[model samples]
Target: MATQVNPPRGMRDFLPVEKRVRDRVLRVIRAAYEHHGFEEIETPVVEDAARLHAGLGGDNEKLAFAVMRRGLEVDDLRAAAAPLELADLGLRFDLTVPLARFIATHRSSLPPVFRAIQIAPVWRAERPQRGRYRQFMQCDIDIAGEPGITAELELLAATGDALTRLGIPDAFIRINDRRILFAALDHAGIAPELHEAALITVDKLDKIGPAGVAAELAERGVDGERLLATLEAIRAGESTGAGGTLHGFDAAALEPVRELLAANAGIRLEFDPTLVRGMGYYTGPIFEIAHPDLPFSIGGGGRYDGMVGRFLGRELPAVGISLGFERLVDLVSLPEEEAGETVALLVDKEVEPTRAIAIKRDLVAAGQTVRMQRRTKNVTALLEQLAASGATHFAFVRPGDTAATLEVKPID
Candidate 1:
């Protein structure tokens, strides 16, 4: 008996039609990024385990697909008591970490402010569900060496434009600042040490609701009431009547981002006091792309001013936004007819093979998707094959005295 073969769990095999849809979506995304002056770049799918464990990826660090040391165990591993000691490299869980390493190594050769577009697959060891996979594609755009809020604005605009191009309607951006979050925690009497615990809880507000998040925070030894009060105070500050500053929350820090969002058409930007994305590297502004039809954010990213500096030995402010390519493909279905019109050339075996090849080349050069096949004895079988090929217009060809003449007709 032969062993059965299958794709690994949480992975998929994309057939021709499925691949076409993915490619079309990616083309739209790439065009949007390129139009905004972002140059495309690629990084390796794997990275040093140390870089992945560098505390920048937040929860994604735990989900990294680690690769074991190939030949010999290091001295650390030879005497180690744990299996994790054997890992020297790991598959990248996200594009940002590798981008940081890329920038650190290539800084002198690159421009001062670099806008990059990276579209690639990343691996994670997570449970697979609809719109979630262990091996998935991330479409990322980042700006390095930009410390101002304009980076955030441009990221949001380009991302929003991409979604719009993909025919996603009623898209909105939920905006927040890490500075505001920390201040709210402080005003709520949460100690510096407990801020992370509280932030993690608050990040689940949409998933579990306000009461659920508060209950979870209390279980984690947080003062839930004070935290809720602090959140309210921050929201109050954003309102029309509140004073310039409340509870040390700097509303001014977000004013520029807010103004930019307001001016952009088709963008419904709102101040989300609870939008604490799990990534610890976010130093300033944070945002999530929201749609009316979905309960979860389709995409998110924020300012990670300290991430690249972890490698570069100096402060390098950067901001990035990621489009959830897989999730978007799930939400937006491409029409079957949009794939392309396939043209099938049924060539008689008696016809000169060179003529058939030449016709195929000509049709291909003219941008028609042409597939050449030898004529079968049964007309019905030939039609079946053409139908299976998804050929919209099929033709029967015979080498004439002068040229190959085609009797073309609709597939139907």
Candidate 2:
């Protein structure tokens, strides 16, 4: 017996119909980004291990898919001091990091402010679940060299337009600035060093709830009561449809963001005080797109002004938004098959082949899809085959017809 073959775990093989739907979705998404003046770019699927494990990718760093050293480099594994030294490169977990490296490497040749659209597959060593895969596509748009809230506004606008075009009915763009979060922690009397520590716990607010968050913060020896009160106050604030204010951060700080939201009609904005986007690299405003139907974010991104500096010698402010292509695809309806008229040209075995060819040419010229097939006495089987191939119209070229005239009829 032969061993059964299948796509590797957490990967998939898309059939023709599936690929069609995926392509259509990609087109819609690409148009949205391109319309915003973003040019497409591609980077290597493999990236330096040093960068992958550099603690910049947030929790995703723990899930880096390392590519083992090969050829002459394989010898180093035997004498390497640590696992990190054994592998030179690994599959990229996200597009943002690679984009930074790309900018640093190609800055001189590229525009000072690079607006990029990266649509590619990224690999991660994550535990796969429904709507989650080890290998999935990410559609991202990032603006490098922009140092203001205007960058965040443009990123959100492009992202929101894309989702709307894709037919995602209702979604909330939950916005929060990391600066505000840090200020809130500072006001709560948390030490500067423990700010990230508290944030890591607070990031689980959506999953664990305030009580769970307080309990975890208490275990960390912080004043959980103080932190919980801060969160509760912000959550209970006035429902402005746009996001409300956090305690320590003055509401005036968000005036620019609020003004941007008011002018951008059709954008459902909400200032979520507890919205802690988990990524460590997000320097300023961070946001996530949430729909009531899905348990997870369909898209999110934020300003990472320091990431480029970490690679390049200088700090270059940048902001980006990424759509979860896999999760977004799951929410939208698949593209339906077009039901255009099709003609299967069934030529009798004894008929001159030119007769059938002429009929097919005529049908094709008339804007109908035509498939040439040999005529068979088994009418039932022939009809079944035509129906299976989705041929809506079929034609018969009989051997007795001297003029090669074809009587084309509806498949029904």
Candidate 3:
């Protein structure tokens, strides 16, 4: 019997071509970020289990992959009060929490106001589906210690530049504030405790529409039709303040956010009163990137003025945006691995090794991507194989052929 082999469920293994494209896309994204003066940083894939469960990662904390302790006796397991108690560490579910911890550990070494970039894989124990995965990459840029909307503007501009460079189609950001959401709930006569439940339904407004949200909210003992109408009015740039619906909402709460929205953020920003990121730590404006073709967002982030402070023992402001790398990979249409004129150096089996190396060096020095392959039985099949793998040109090396004398032919 043959054994069935596969990567872990919800995980993936990229083929050579797929990997090449991914690297290229990553490079483009990195360049865009660096152009905006954001420096890249790295953190351990695993963090202390306590930090992972620190109530800052929102629902992502629930999906963290716990790493059990290295040495646990049977008695310890029996004595354990909770499953996670046996685990000392967990794979980080998102980059933000780790970033917060990172700054706390490296505060003295970093600048007072630090702009950092992190591109890495994070693990989540999710029920994998089309766009969701157990293991996936997140590209995040965060500004820490700058206490104003400048950080938000910088993140938006930089993220927009990356999207532009990737040529993401019809991408826009929907902006909202936690304050706005709470005010909407309050104005709708929904109890404070039901705010979370109402926001959950509101986030689905696009998919379920007003009627559906009303139905769902009604089930929770709150009629939300008026709430949805008020949100719609806000979305249309109409103020409900004159009608007394925006009560408990400090107009100043939106002053800075309005300034952020009005800035030339380098991308379209639509104020959404119903937008809720579900991250409990978001203390201010939150946003998500939307595309015309997709039912879901590709990326988003917002201010968490309270998170970093929790780690550093004092409140420090921080905000970041993450590009949903997996979704971006699906949406991006890039030319497969175009690294200039690639040359396949087909060396005859009898050719001297030194001679082939010398020839390859010359082609490489000429700025061509060079790959040396021993001549095979079926030369045409070999050329086709090379061409399929992104070889654009080919050169033959025989016993006496010099690098200067060899003819380089186009693969096609």
Candidate 4:
């Protein structure tokens, strides 16, 4: 029996065409960030297990992929208290944690206020589904050490530039603050101990309607009725709508939300008081990018003034945004690759190998993408394969024909 060849569950394998789109989109995003004065940086895919499991990751820590301690004996495995006990390192679930550590490690050499670009793949042990993967890429730009609301605004502007450059319209960002969320809890008389759990319940308000949330919260031995009523009023777009002053918001948190709405230009941003980002590290002013055509957010981030401090022992203001690469790639339709003509150089079997190499080399040097292939009897099938592999045109190299004399024809 032949062995089945496939990628591991929840992972994916991209063909040549798919990879071309992915690479092009990544370049577009990277170019946008750099144009906004953000410089790219890289970090390892793995981090210390202790750091990965810290409270900052929220629910993501449960889904992290742990790397077992090296050189573990059978005795070590048997005596372990839990699965994670045998693991010393883990694949990072998100870029923020690793970036926090990176800044802490290299802060002295970096600028006073650093704008870093991180475009990389992160791993999560998620149940495989459409637009959800165990491994995927995140395009993130973060500003650190800027304590003011400027960092949030800059992150939003940079992300908007990326989406606009990709030709996506109708995308808007919804802003909120963790402080406001807690303030709402305080106004409703919810205990501090139940705040986190209560917020988790509220986050699901969309999936399960008010009735469902009320039921669940009641089952949790709490009355969320008044909180849900206030949330419904907020969603009704009464006192707080786009580009309008917030009325019922907490007095201190009110001004920043107003600034985000009034100052946003490149994209439409609204105030979503109920927008509870899942990450536990967020301190203030959270926002998420949404499109009218999609039911879920395509990107989101917020201020985390204390994450770097987890490593540096002192909190520094940090704000960032990440575009969901896999989800957004489907919505983008870029023009076909136009940098250069992709040419397949077909040479006869009797043609000298050096001649083919010389022709391919010359074509490549002349700013054309050239792939050399031996001429086959099934020219139609060969041309089909080449075109599927991203060839735009083909040239037949005859025994006497030089590079200048070959006849070129479009594959289509």
User: What TM-score number comes out for model 4?
Assistant: 0.93
lDDT of 4: 0.86
Model 4, poorest ten-residue lDDT window? 237-246
Sort by TM-score, top down from the best: 4, 3, 1, 2
How does model 3 score by TM-score?
0.88
Candidate 3, pairs of clashing residues: none
Worst 10 residues of 3 by lDDT: 238-247
lDDT tens string, model 3, 1-412? 9886999999999987788888888998999999999999999999999998988887788899999999899999999998999999999999999999999999999998999999999999999898999999999999998987888988988888899989984799989888877767776778988888888888778788888989998998887897887666555553434423344544555666578766898888877778889798998899999998888899999989999888899988898999999999988987654368888989998999998998888877887789999998899999999988888899888999887898989987
Error of 2 at 408 (Å): 5.9
Over 4 Å off, model 4: 233-250, 352-355, 398-405
TM-score (all chains, Cα) for each model: 0.87, 0.82, 0.88, 0.93
Pairs of residues clashing in candidate 1: none
Q: Arrange candidates by lDDT, descending.
A: 3, 4, 1, 2
Candidate 2, 57-117: lDDT as tens digits: 9999888888777763556766788777777899999999999999999999888888999
For all candidates in order, the CA lDDT equals 0.83, 0.81, 0.86, 0.86
| Clashes per model (N, Cα, C within 3 A) | 0, 2, 0, 0
For model 1, residues 242-333, the per-residue Cα lDDT tens digits are: 63467455556556545655576345788777788999998888888899888878899999999898899998999999988888987876
Estimate the overall C-alpha local distance difference test score of candidate 1.
0.83
- What's the lDDT of the predicted structure labeled candidate 2? 0.81
What lDDT tens digits, residue by residue, belong to model 4 across residues 10-57? Answer: 998999888989999998989999999999999999999999998989
Estimate the TM-score for candidate 2.
0.82
